[model samples]
Target: MIQLKSLQRVNPRDVEAPKKFYVQAVGAGKTDLDRLAYLISNQSTVRKPDCYAVLEALLHNMMDELREGRIIELGNIGNFQIGVSSDAVDTEEEVTSNLVRKAKISFRPAKALRDLLQTVNYKKVS
Candidate 1:
């Protein structure tokens, strides 16, 4: 289940518009690799340590591949790719690597994950 919180936000399109309450999903906390490993181990035959090691290795490899300009696709989960935010140059000749503001990893969820969203249950919280 997901917990949602109501927040008041101003509409950027109309500065004079009244602020409205919107529902935003509030995170419960975080689940670290150790917790994930334990959970996975409980659902399968793999040991927790093995699961942790594999997950750790996966993190390292995913970084390396993303740096190499390759997308890392986890069959049913999602695919991750590197993206950049840059300032626009006035001319083609003015464009340079320095214009890039930052690099970020983007994730695109698979169909299975998208379908899972349809079955999610939520509760509103103060």
Candidate 2:
């Protein structure tokens, strides 16, 4: 089950304004890749080792493609791409690799994944 937690965060700028109450995810209740392969092996003819190897290869290839400035799309899964944030430059000539403050991998969830999220049952952590 999806687990949630409530937390109070103090506002450093205005202590008199009172702390804000926020709800966050405590756990998604996930299984690791090896465990996932084992579970898949139980339902299919493929052995766990084969399933794990395939998963590892898929990851390696996906990373390689992403590094080559290509968006990786897993059908009915999501699209993954690289994103960057940079410091503001006064002119185009001032823009350079050094200006890049951070790089991030972004994922745009597919419609099917969004639908799955809607169906999950959540309970607050006690």
Candidate 3:
């Protein structure tokens, strides 16, 4: 069994602030830092210059691909494809119809994230 240090043993300040911000400002409903701290200390969070910047870039790329009517597949994760509704379809059946015009983006979690979630063990609830 792997031994892991509790959040209290690590940078308590950094850990506490974000948890509070998420709960109070973001309205996360409840502030729970135990799991977040575990993942952070274990280096599970994706490393980048800034999380928002990375997300912005990812969204931009996904939107660009969607607009071009192309599916974007993230490794280990799922693919994003633009969706079409029956209401949007034309009555006349036409071969090679350029009906898929609107852009949409979807997300699928990676296998690593899924596996990690499945294997995560929490401390006994008091």
Candidate 4:
């Protein structure tokens, strides 16, 4: 089950109103590539080493494709692409690579993933 915790604002603008709380997800653990490869090996015919090697190469290829302006759609997973946050420019001519202040990888989950999220169970962290 996913764990969550109560979160409240430190300072409330409406002094007369009672404090309100929100629920935020609390991670249970972290899973690294090696652990994932082992799990894959246990579930499939592929060996652990082979799984890790293929995954490592796949990551490099994904990066290369994104750098080349390709939006990668992994089947039943998501679409991945590079996005940029740039400074405001007055005209189209003023827009340039130099204006980009940050670059980020964007992911849009597939229908299956979104559906799964809707069904996942969560519990409050005590």
lDDT winner among the candidates?
A: 1
Worst 10 residues of 1 by lDDT: 60-69
lDDT of 2 by residue, 47-91 (tens): 999999988898999999999989999999999999999999899
Write candidate 3's Cα lDDT for 9-112 as tens digits: 33466655533211111222443344444445467465433444555678788789888989888888767787663336455665234655553455666777
Error of 3 at 63 (Å): 0.9
Clashes of each: 0, 0, 0, 0
Each candidate's lDDT (Cα)?
A: 0.96, 0.91, 0.55, 0.92
- Compute the lDDT of residue 46 as modeled in candidate 4: 99
Root-mean-square deviation of each candidate, in angstroms? 1.2, 1.7, 15.2, 2.4
lDDT tens digits by residue: candidate 4, 7-86: 97544677777767888999899998899899999999999999999889989999999999999999899999999998
Residue 68 displacement (Å), model 2: 0.8
Model 2 stretches with alpha carbons more than 4 Å out:
11-16
Error of 1 at 38 (Å): 0.4
lDDT of 3: 0.55
Candidate order by decreasing TM-score: 1, 2, 4, 3
Q: Against the true structure, what is each candidate's TM-score? A: 0.93, 0.89, 0.39, 0.89
